[model samples]
Target: MTSTPEPWGPVEPLEPALSVRRVLTLERVLAGEPEVVAGAAQLDRPVRWVHVAEAADVGVMLTGGEMVLTTGVLLAGDENAQAEYIRSLHRAEAAAVVLGLGRAFPTTPDVMRRAAERCGLPMVVLHRPFPFAELTEEVQSRLVRRKFAAVSLSEAVRTALTGLITAGAPLQRLLDEIAHHTGCPVVVTNLAHRVLATAGERPAVDDVLRDWERIARQAGGSEGDGWIRAELGGRGERWGQIMLCGYRGDTAGGRLLADRAAEALVLHRMLGGTSAHTWEEQSAQSLLTDLVSGVVPARQLLPRARAAGLPVNRRTFVPLVVRDGDPAQLERMLRLLGLPGLVAEFAEGAVAVLLSLARDQDADALAAHFATRLRTESGESRTVVAAADPRIVWDDVPTGLREAQHVADAVADSSAALDLPAVVRLRDVHLRGLIRLLRDDPHVQSFAERELDGLLCAGAGDDLLAVLRTYLASGRNKSRTAQLHHVSRPALYRRLEAIEARLGVDLDDFEQAASVHIALLAHDAQQA
Candidate 1:
């Protein structure tokens, strides 16, 4: 039942003082020889305040969570009034009722006892006369101290988190601090319930993620257990929430931790500027980069991948790279295609996508579909999608990612042969692939510089270079090269003759043309 809030004091997210069980243990209250009459199961309910009232209708004045101390002096003989009094107190949501027995019909009354037991309200009876003033003073002072302590906790957490942020600490360090304060697994997730970042003990966190689907489903709304979430957003745009999984504390303190943690996170993002990616994107980028770099063993990352909500058990992993693709748009495309994948921009102008598929699914078909849909959605018909053979084991993923990147780099060569497929692979790149791999070698660089020096040093270096690239890419067909360059065959022959004179090599010789083409390809790859 909703009641009017107290207006005189602080309405912190966490309030309320001691529980009924704790209150019973107080020396002042125990001096009265208090005995549990009924409703013992609810003794743990929080007692926000102490109210001493003899009026039968005192429940109307309550704002809930009050520990009411009544003597029953107003109703000595009326059974109906006694019963209705307990019923009214229960309706008021009082934490518990302490009855002084001397003036209120001696021993426990059946009517009041039965009513409190029915409503599950803790009912206590004092055998000796107890000073209501003393109990009220002790509980209220303690409640005030608790409120002050709560304020202190809030400031402490805020100050610590702020200090970390000011020191330019990373997101993981901030989350770790929050986890240390709460002593629970902390999870930050997107609106789609995908875990973006996590901190806490590894075993406990893994336990929380083991049944993540159901837990994510239940992430919405306030739950009775230790789960508390604080919505994370600013400027009226809520993108996600921060959760305290299985936090062991009062509701108010738990919420304070969550809200403070969330505020620190939002501030971290805001201060990080535009390059500050969403936690999920950053997480994926870190994971995939590590996988491709092979700095960390794949087994160590398996748990992190799983905790991040990616399927990694006995699944087929496909590695793909898109040249100059938008990571955000690619991620959206992955979702739209109903495929399970992680997309991140691991390198400048190069975005990597890792797809986890079931063994029964056709990896090739899905990959093709992804490529086709990406082109259509992006409206870049010539955009290249490079992929490697699907890997079944997690350990082989790094090799697959490297291979896919290699394929992507190979096809990025502008001087490569024409008519490349929509999705370029290792086999499709062929000889150009080898040249790309060797583009960085000193011998290859020297060879390319030596072979291309004639045209490169000429006045119309770029113009003639384009002509030569087209001529060689067309497999030495002068007619096609002239058409592609929008020049008549006579003009093209004159340029080709000049090229042969400058380079001192015949363009018609198969081996010479092939060597020149390979050199040009290497130069282009290096430049790219």
Candidate 2:
């Protein structure tokens, strides 16, 4: 599925809390002509607050993320004190330290510089006398504004996503909302890096996923250039991650968007009471449902199928529909058997599955194995897997799916009582299949109505209809029909005679009996 159309103009990317790099650019700090003395590479580190202190143990009164400003007066006389001071700042995770020089020391000190360099704490020196309060006031105000903006953005996104979840919007719609806010492609993946869903500007999203395998392999550790990732899980179990692909916003803001999206997804799953596997099934459901319904052309859906981790290129497609089988269980079984396939439930209660297999693989054997294994696993001997002829072209899958569904429908009734093959093919259903295929034909309907009209009348009340069903399904064997219906032979004979008399037919005549049975099958198939 495609992303929801963008309804508004471009959203300005989020700004992170003031960074030391940003701090250095301020007019107040720039007035002193600041020079980077040490740890110049980490300029982008966030500065939560600005502090001015000359006490060596000033790091004790501080929390992390503070940019400490000092005059170096207390640090100049003692080398150990200077080194300890830098170490303390590093341990406290201070953002950076700026040393202003005048009476404290006319220039940057080698001892303090060496300590800051060793500890990897950003150290800056003022070349001219400058008021520290000016820089502090400017940076703190900016930090407060950025923090406010971040909180407002977070709350806005959370509210939007919550509304979508409450409205019963699916996962794709939620991702679309996230992409709309971030102006970036949103990607959701399982632990193995299988892409389950994606949304964003179509071209940008396609570009991000064009080389997804390589990108996924290289993506590790913390945030990359706009690539913000958040864990998608709850209760101490992380099943996957949600990522903003090529998010060019500030890291903290990208983080906020990713985090809000992740929270919404987790809460959505919890409220919907579905597992990760169920979400995967839903994705498959959307894709397969579209394919079978033919609402969207197959060529347009190729990209989605490929992005969903299905190997679609140059493969054989085996379409199989199982009667009354669980989609989740079928998908798991496919994985256990080391096959690549997509499983989704059809509108008519049958689970439709499409297997992607290599050209040289034995498709029939694997399909049979899947059906047999599913039967064994579910302990359901009556499960019918109606198989359609494998198609080599992707465009032909819709027809194959319809054929599979039709065959499955054909077997839905007789499979339980009759000994149906584990993997029921089109030819296996024979007359039953033809009846189902022709159930909607006007002539077939008229013929069925004409032949079975007596039993279908309002006065019949389904008594003789039930007897006829059992007698016909038992292949005209009266004794077996009597035993199955839990009635004696004389009682079954009387019912059969009543059925024959009401329909103006002879049960002993093979041709008449076969016609009535076919009409009954056609009627039942039509009703189904």
Candidate 3:
């Protein structure tokens, strides 16, 4: 990850809208001797606006979520009119209705009270004469201020995230910015619901991810508690979503934060590079790379693995490295095998896979099975599958990965002419592997050139070198070498004579053949 200086100051979060209950508790509104007459439980409804109306059909002139202030002068005489007025307010989805006392009626109307109770609409009655203008002014001013604050908060978050994006922050840092602003758990996921990145305060993130699958499934719909999501990507190319769970602030504010975070993430990914793989794969690649680097401890990554749907406890861990293989194909193969693990592209033409084995499973057999499956499926000639020893815990996975990677790299560097086994281990390429590991040593190069100098100075074509390789591979049998190369016995004899004349050595001697074979191996390793 690239680190850049913070370009913006901290942003203060916005206050949520004042609820009907909060409005009732205001000093000005409370001074009106307001008393809840019905639907006390509905007082928490958000009051978007405060309207003062004294008419029979005020509901028609008003929109929803308004706290209506009116005297009952329009319904003073008719009981049906009073009930209809309350029903109309309920139908309009009004937050609450405040009926000013004195003049409309000396006491609260029973018809309106019964109607409000039946419809579950909050009904408030002022015990004394109260100025509707004063109450409306106070509530409207507060509502406008809240709206301004929300807009300001949106701008602040957008600015902060844009600055971070410009600074080249990664996906996790963008999510961290959202979590910091919202004081909640933030999660980024692909279309497949795989967790890409998560950020928040510590234990809260843990609690949110403990049963991550269930929570994520529930999050698909908008039924969970304060789990707000903003879609990522645009122009008909939706890729993922950003979710905030257990946000303490208003849903609107949380949504603002999520939207801003989503925008920043989309821009960051676009600016970096384009790939066919989704962000989920990128997330897996980043995690695997981090594990391989060993800069962060394995224990710290356990939570992330678990959150990504890996079973981390009381299981066997099998680390595999494949050279010249496709990681996306490997991931599909794992799913087809009903295995739970992670697959990631480690480097060009190489992939890394972490498989979770059962306690009763045989590690060697499973590794061989995986290697055979890959060979059969991919049909790539030079595929190398290297497996590390099984680990029983998550913390030991990094060690296993390092071992597998080393083996894979060694095998990749080995001579391509050698007949490699379907599944390669460190022992398979023992001596040649050591030479390749030390290929950079000046002494090794000098030895190899000195050993093969006679044949090299002859200016011979590759045919003689091919003959030498086949002869050594055939265990120094002239008949087998001739048969393998499709040449007559006398022709093979002539080639062998020419080779000995050039190198001044007997092909039939064991010590001489061994030295030349070792030299050839060193030469191939150096070229590789």
Candidate 4:
């Protein structure tokens, strides 16, 4: 059976001392409100009469918006205590003070006015006796209204979320809606710590994720899942954090709401492809892609990075190709380095590092340590290479990437023969020799076309072509190809038909196609 929603709680009555007008006045206050002491400036502003037992102890008793009412009995003998009392009231953000015209404070002293004026605390006096009962009733009405307003706001949130769900809203749209309703900037990051959606001063919060990583770690871990509320500035000061815990309320109602929102966001992301990426792997792959003509420099990308606070100087730097098992593994290795001045792009299943090394000796040590750490983590028996200091300009990442990939490829290819981990430099390899061989062999060019050209030409749907290349490369063995492609035996046969139709090649007749494959490889070698 479905349970009914919880009804709004009954409104609580305000304190008898305060009047309705005064509590209402607080809602309009921003900064620098006037200070009126005693009944001198009755017409100046609205006042709430918050009675205090001890005039001297008003500071501790004053919260954000109370107007202190006292008989001044505590200021009987000490001027310093009197001055301190007024100052405390001001500092505690009291709306105003009312001095009852009787007892020890029968007359408003000049010191009281000066202190109140100096500290900016308003002072008021009741000209004639007023009933506390009538004041309390009025104040209670205002309090009830305010409570209802809060409930209305909560209901609005529910309505907005329902509208979004019905309208099939995107994550970005949802975040924008939430920010609009909350009257605060909002940022939503995925489990992988990448910002998914943001509203309100997004550009200002570009470095938020990076900075928040440390904050999150201190909170617990990078994947810390909870709503954290903290005051923005000082204690009880302006801009304080009003975070909800556990992505919801610390306890009941808010918790369920926040949890539901989080789940909806997750589902939205799954449909929208806003999933967090594995940085290290993505970085390496991007670097390699840039080098191997896998991707072109996009104008849209760097602007997005800048918006996220990754201020890439894009001037003089070295492109360090950092390879490891994965992003988590690379992060661990980086921490183990125990050195400073290292920033990395963890993208495309690879780690492309940028290091600011003052000492040449330190550079060498960084490379060696990174390589050793990589080997330990990779477990793939691969030797990862860290590039030599190459002057990489913003536009030159592609060229630098090419150099990085060439060096790494040479290392990887040589690993088996040399029984050494591959960490070769591109310039160190005999590019001229490879080029000359390709130039002399015309058949190699044709072979590459017959074998690999179709893979590139298929546009986005090239997986079938890819299977064909691997199948052919493995010497036409169905079992080996099936294992490499991660397909069942029957699926392998189906993939072969798709591949053959797309490539227009007869894989069954390998003898005739061998010549064409050789020619295409020759062309690639020349380009290398």
lDDT of 3 at 264: 79
Q: Is candidate 1 or candidate 3 better by TM-score?
A: 3
Tens digits of per-residue lDDT, candidate 2, 1-528, equal 434333334445566568889889988888999999999988889888999988999889889999999998887878899889998999999999999988878988888899889888999999999998888888888878877787877877777788778777778888887898787899888887777888998778777777677767866766677888998998889998898988877778888889999999999899989878777777788888889899988886776687678888899999999988887798889889999988888666799999999999999999999999999999988888999999999999988998899899988767336567779987988899888888989999999999998888838639788789878887888898899889999998888888888899998999999999999999889888
For candidate 1, what is the TM-score?
Answer: 0.76
CA error at residue 125 for candidate 1, angstroms: 1.3
- Compared with the true structure, what per-residue lDDT tens digits does model 4 show for residues 1-528? 333233223322222223323442443221223234543443233333344546576678655666565657778667888788888887887766766555575556678778877766666554444343444455556656645654664565565565565456655566555544333445544333333344544443334433554543453332224444322222333321223323321222333334434444544545555433332233333333444363545332343333232334533435566554344555566667753222344343345554433333455555666677677677765556646455534455555555564454444333123434344454454542243334445565555665666555777435764565566556678998899778999998987776666656776776645643443334444554
Provide the clashing-pair count of each candidate structure.
1, 0, 0, 49
Off by over 4 Å in 1: 1-17, 162-170, 221-225, 234-237, 269-277, 299-315, 357-361, 372-382, 413-419, 431-528
Query: TM-score of model 4 relative to the true fold?
Result: 0.46
The residue ranges of model 3 lying beyond 4 angstroms of the native Cα positions read 1-7, 223-225, 275-278, 293-300, 311-315, 332-339, 347-350, 357-366, 376-379, 413-417, 431-528
lDDT of 3 by residue, 177-231 (tens): 6787777898887777667878888678767777677877776676346888988
Cα error of candidate 3 at position 141, Å: 1.6
Q: Among all windows of ten consecutive residues in candidate 3, which has the lowest summed lDDT? A: 274-283
Q: Report the error of model 3 at residue 510, Å.
A: 14
Q: Give the alpha-carbon lDDT of every model.
A: 0.86, 0.86, 0.81, 0.49
